[model samples]
Target: MILLQLLFSFLQVGLLSIGGGYAALPIIQNQVVDLNHWLTAREFGDIVTISQMTPGPIAINAATFVGTKIAGVPGAIVSTLGTVLPSFVIVLFLAWFYYKYRQLKSIKAVLKGLRPAVTALIAASGVSMIIACFWPDGAVSLNNLNIESFILFAGAFIVLRKFKAGPIKVMIACGLVALIISYI
Candidate 1:
């Protein structure tokens, strides 16, 4: 019964989230933190971190993590399946619809419109994650900020933007720096 409920909640997240994986963050945060009480605010930040570091859609990774944390192996499987099932069905439908309507101007226009919205959602997710990382307790006050993270954020942004460094290189460099800093 708990598994069923978890699956249903994830399914709803998968089905309703429109802009993509990043857009799923707010919904996932709400469901897991507010509705389910499965993870605390700090743990939720860890969830976002893990989701970003993982290889797949953020929503699917989050579901798996949350489920595993809550109920172990069976829970992970059920939650992952729940999150992916919606995308799988939607992809099939879109694949058929897209080819059939490939030349439709309205479809093209809609796609163009969605591009900006998706970009905005991705940007918002980045900003939100930055805040969550620097203030795990949801502290909006500047006095409570994590200086190391902010410096890392600024440095990474400059390297990526001005120097045009490859992301993998940047991440590896940042990880090494963080490791060395922690030892000091």
Candidate 2:
């Protein structure tokens, strides 16, 4: 039963997560954190962080992690499969469709129209993560702000944008900094 639930939830995520892994964050959150109660918001945030640090797509990583947490290895397999299937089928069909209609203005317009929506999805996900980081308890007050999290975020952003550091390097640096801070 839990396997079925994992499959179904990830199937929905796979089918509707149209833009990319970042854009799929909110949808995945809805299914796992909000709807199923499979993971808390904090755990979801950690999964997102781990997903970003890892190689594979965020949605697939998240599905595997969430599934394993809920129902072990079998759950991970089912969830990962469910998360990938729709993308595989959709991309296969879309490739054929785009190849056949490569010159059509309508197809071009449709593709162009999707860009903004995808951008918005990514932005929304980023904003939610910011909120979660700043206010883990759901209250928006200065007293509740996570100073260490804010410092890590700011420092990482500066290193990535200004210093032009590689993402992996920035992530590792931040992890080390956070670890040291935690020990202090």
Candidate 3:
């Protein structure tokens, strides 16, 4: 039953979450955290972190993790299958459709309009994660700010933007810095 629930919930996430993994964050959070109460907010955040660090697409990784946490290996398989099924079918259909209608002004306009919506979804997810990182208690207040996290965030942003450092390098540096900070 739990495996079925995981599959069904992630199916909705895969079907409805347009744009990509970043954009799917909110929908996945809503399903697992808000609606189903399978994972707490903190657990969801941890899953997101783990998903990002893993090799696969964030959505698939998240589904696998959530399923495993909720049930077991079978749950992981079901959830992952549910998550990718819609995307696989949709992509195949879109590829053929786009190939056939590549010159259509309506298709072009639709794709153009979707860009802003996708950007908004990604931004919303980012803001939620930022709030979660800065305020672990879920309250937005100066007293609740995590200075270490803020500093790490600022340093990472600067490294990526100013130095054009690769993300893996920045992640490694941040991990080292965090490890040092923990002992200090």
Candidate 4:
């Protein structure tokens, strides 16, 4: 029963979350925080933080974490599958259809239009994550702020933008900085 619930909950999120992991954050928050009461908003934010540090999409990591929290390994497995299944099915169908309609100019035009929309959605997700990092409750006040995180975020942004260093290097540098700061 718990596994089924986990599966369905994630399936709903997976089907509707068009943009990606960050896009799914609000849905996950509602499910885990408001509906099931499985975890608090702070815990969800922590999960998002850990998810960003790992490989793969944020949504999958979130489903695994929340599932494990709810019903252990089995729940994690179910939730992960549920989250991926829709994407698998949709992509397979679209690939086949696109191959069949390869010569259709209208189809190509539609896809071209879709590219920008998808990019926009992904960009929106990034903005959402940035907002979450600074203001988890949607409030931007200096009193309940994390200065270390702000410093790390600003430094990372500058390094990535100016130096054009690869993401792995940036992550490693950020991790080292965080580790050193933690001991201070």
lDDT agreement with native, every candidate? 0.88, 0.92, 0.90, 0.86
What is the Cα root-mean-square deviation between model 4 and the actual structure? 4.9
lDDT of 3 by residue, 82-167 (tens): 99899889899989999999679998899899899999978999998899888878889998899999999999999899999999
Q: In model 1, which runs have C-alpha deviations exceeding 4 angstroms?
A: 1-79
For candidate 3, the clash count comes to 0
Per-residue error for 50 in candidate 3, Å, reads 7.6
> What lDDT tens digits, residue by residue, belong to model 4 across residues 49-111?
898778988889888999998999999999999899988999899899999996799988998
Arranged by TM-score, best first: 4, 3, 1, 2
Best candidate according to lDDT? 2
Measured against the true structure, the TM-scores of the candidates, in listed sequence, are 0.61, 0.60, 0.62, 0.64
Question: Which segments of candidate 4 are over 4 A away from where they belong?
Answer: 112-184
- Predicted structure 3: lDDT: 0.90
**What lDDT does model 1 reach?**
0.88
Model 3, which residues run further than 4 Å from truth?
1-79
